[model samples]
Target: MDVRTGLFYLFSVVLLFAAFRVITARNPVYAALYLVLTFFRASGIWLLLRAEFPAITLVLVYVGAVMVLFLFVVMMLDIDVDALRAGFWKHFPIAASVGALIALEMAAVLMGGFRASEEPRALPGVAAAAQAGVQFSNTKELGKLLYSEYLYPLEIAAVLLLVAIIAAIALTLRHRKDSKQFDPAQAVRVRASDRLQVIKVAPTRPAAPPAAPDTPAAETK
Candidate 1:
């Protein structure tokens, strides 16, 4: 086996392990961290396949941004692992069956890849483009297909993800007795006049009042 095949196997194994841990880890923070590992491994696999765009995107977008955000949120929230695991065993059998079904489907797909004919039928456009001495680029082809054929589905997926992010933010906005909230509406409405008041008062005389006008002072006078 060559270095590339060895690297592929290494990354694949690690990726599968990380993915399993992501689902089964008791600690949410650990689960999220494992997910980051999974992304890294998957990115390595993409790199091995000469898919630079997807590899970089997986590393930069998921591992760098999304998974980091997940880790931060998981850590900050201090979620109870025990509570999360409370009914896990009760649900495990069903989850396991579903997992098995997915695994079998994946196995079928992978086996079919091995059974594919050594020669693939060629498309005229791709063949003509190749013959024209244009540099072969999977990334360019991916971009073309994504923007043309899969554009609508890609856009819908993006909108769904945006909605999910908004929903998570909304969920985290639960009223906390210790949390302080600043209403932008109230803040914007507050004027400098309301924030500060300046009152002018007549200066008091340095001398004491004239012995209260009467009493002992009037008698002495």
Candidate 2:
């Protein structure tokens, strides 16, 4: 095929591989790195689609910010892979069902997009601007669409993100029996004696006087 199509396929293949590795990799750090790769490939695909804003945003937002944070957390945390996977077989059926449902939904959406027969129709203003040969900004148009048509969905997404942030904080801040939590106020007010102790014992015995070394006897001459 042409160069664009070739690049698209290349990015798609790498993206799929990286996405798969994100889920299957045993090391969490490797998984996060793979996810970063997935985002980069996705951004490249978006660039090929001529959606520059989305491509840049994907790289800057997800790759630069989110993936860095994910990598930091994954690397810092002592993740118990065995304990985490202990219930995997027990939960496999439900997880499989949910995954299948999501796959079906994605298939449906892709099928509908492919089946669309009509050419993409731009907004009336955008069409007029195009006819007049006025420079158009897709980013501006996207902003308008987000603030107008998709406002509710955008607000809902923000709320959901906020809820997720709160939930994560709640989970992290939860008290654990095994954790050695200390009160800062109590620690600050403590006396040195509470934290340290010094004891004196009588000397085992008085210091012995130094013994004088005998001079070597002069060689019998």
Candidate 3:
């Protein structure tokens, strides 16, 4: 096999192994790390397809932002491994059934690969267009579809994501007694006198000597 084909197989094998580990690993952190490895392998496959934009986007978005956030959450949270696994056997039958169904669906989808025809090469006119200084890019085609045909769908997706973000914030938010909140309107309306206080006091003075009774003074003398 050629170098490209060899690399593709190599990446695909590693990607599958990593993906399996992500599901089967005992440690959550290890599973997350394996997932990161899977993303990297997928990016490599994208690069092999000459889709630079998708490869870079996978690295920057999933590996950089989403995976880091996941890792941070996993590490920072307290999780009980034994307690988590205690009910695994109880849930395994259903989980396995669902997993099998998904696997079958994926297999059915991928089976089409054996029958799908290869994409035709560029037409003579298209080749001439390339020679005439028109740059060819899959990213350009993707951008055109995203902006023109998929624009409304994309906007709706963005709005849904935004709503989901707001909902998550609302759900996870706790009203902690220790957390002090400020009123912006009250702060803006405050004057110097309202913010600052001054206390007045008398100047320092020496204590007066106590006067003794007349009989006690005579006895001292």
- Pick the lDDT winner: 3
User: Which tens-of-lDDT digit does each residue in 1-221 have in candidate 1?
Assistant: 99999999999999999999988787788888899989999989998977789899999999889988887887788677888789989999999999899989999887865665756545665687789987667778889999999999999999999999999999888778898887779999999999999999999979866654557967988
TM-score of each candidate structure, all chains considered together: 0.61, 0.62, 0.64
Alpha-carbon error at 139 in model 1, in Å? 1.8
lDDT of each: 0.87, 0.90, 0.91
Superposed on all Cα atoms, model 2 deviates from the true structure by an RMSD in Å of 8.6
Candidate 3 ranges with C-alpha deviation above 4 Å:
116-135, 149-178, 182-221
TM-score, cand. 3: 0.64
Tally clashes: model 3. Answer: 0
Q: Compared with the true structure, what per-residue lDDT tens digits does model 2 show for residues 166-188?
A: 99999987889998777779988
What does the lDDT read for residue 200 in candidate 3? 100
Where in model 1 is the C-alpha error above 4 Å?
116-134, 144-221
Ranking by TM-score: 3, 2, 1
Model 3: lDDT equals 0.91
